[model samples]
Target: MISSIFFYSTAFVLFLIGLFGVLTRKNIIKILVSLSITETAVNLFLVTVGYIKNGKAPILTNTIGSIGMNNLKFVDPLPQALVLTAIVIGLGTTALSLVIAIKLYKNYGTLNITKMGGKR
Candidate 1:
């Protein structure tokens, strides 16, 4: 079985990479992409928070024969639900940001953030 530590570390690494991209990139689209990456990493981290070793699905089935908590090791579903909502919201925001980026490019004739400033 894979350790929870692995999932955590992977999420952390993805977050750091996204952070680096957001800080270092000068293009508006690239920044938005990095922001999306960061969002994905956060979602991943949230999902990992509900991880349980040898956990079964949260759904109750008769095969298990008991509804008692003591006999079940079900993974928490809250984080998964939250992540699902976040994914939808993130998609909307990403699309909106892309539209804004298009407008910025049209107005400035450039996608580079630094270059968007008025000519010196």
Candidate 2:
């Protein structure tokens, strides 16, 4: 439940920030940074989805005299899978955005996005 709340809250905040950047920011770099923040927040939420409360490692150990194998809670596999996917996606997004930012910076010769292609 806590994870759910955190995930949603972080996502929402990131969304708002991204929207703000999209709506109000003139600089492409600032917009890109905001986009990255949103992406990171989403990735964070995705990775957090894999967390298991009180979950034990997936390693197997010899059973004790009377204990059964049923009580142990193995790490949840779903979250781990999701995290991996999110990581890949995040990397792709970062690379793509960085490339775009570089292009814009090179063309404009300045980091200020509003000034980009100003004389164009």
- Residue pairs in steric clash, candidate 2? 50-79
lDDT of each: 0.91, 0.72
Q: Least accurate stretch of 10 residues (summed lDDT) in model 2? A: 58-67
- Local lDDT at 50 for model 1: 93
User: For candidate 1, what is the lDDT?
Assistant: 0.91
**Candidate 1 residue runs with Cα over 4 Å from true position:** 66-69
The estimated TM-scores of all candidates read 0.90, 0.66
For model 2, residues 1-120, the per-residue Cα lDDT tens digits are 465677768877887887788678877767777877777777666655665767666667775323567777767677667777877887898789889878877777876765665466
Candidate 1 clashing pairs, residues 3+ apart or interchain = none
Best by lDDT: 1
lDDT (C-alpha) at residue 74 in model 2: 69
